[model samples]
Target: MKSRRFMQPLTSPIHFHTAMIEQTPVAVFLGQEMIGSGKIVQITDYIVKIGNEFYVRDACTFKYAV
Candidate 1:
């Protein structure tokens, strides 16, 4: 019989960076599904404000709209 081992997940804060400016159109995604699309209104260290909705910085993915 083989034994299984599980490793603890890292709890350190993640640093996110973006070059997109405010008012730029973007598509927000959680996992692989697109959740919303809007222009970026504000950005902070922990979250991003898009069209009155705030999403966690590390929890969602952003794709710039052309």
Candidate 2:
């Protein structure tokens, strides 16, 4: 049997960078499915704040500049 160890994010969210600014509306995706769209307000190491909610980068599938 193999032992499983807990792992954390490779990098800190503080280092995350976003080329866009707050309120820059963008489409959200989860794989081929379009989840929805929201104005980008914040960017963390792993998550993005859209409108007033936050979403994980790994979850979103696609984003189109709008």
- Which has the greatest lDDT? 1
Q: Which residue pairs collide in model 2, if any?
A: 13-45, 29-61
lDDT of 2 by residue, 1-66 (tens): 321311122133332333243333466667766666656677765777766777788776435344
TM-score of 2: 0.57
> Could you tell me the lDDT of residue 1 within candidate 1?
36
lDDT of 2: 0.53
Give one clash count per candidate, in the order shown. 0, 2
Which ten-residue region of model 2 has the weakest summed lDDT?
Answer: 2-11
Taken over the whole model, the C-alpha lDDT of each candidate is 0.59, 0.53
Residues 1-66, candidate 1: write the lDDT tens digits.
321211221123321223244344667788888787777667777777778999887898776553
User: Which parts of model 1 are misplaced by more than 4 Å?
Assistant: 1-22
lDDT at residue 40 of model 2 (Cα atoms): 63
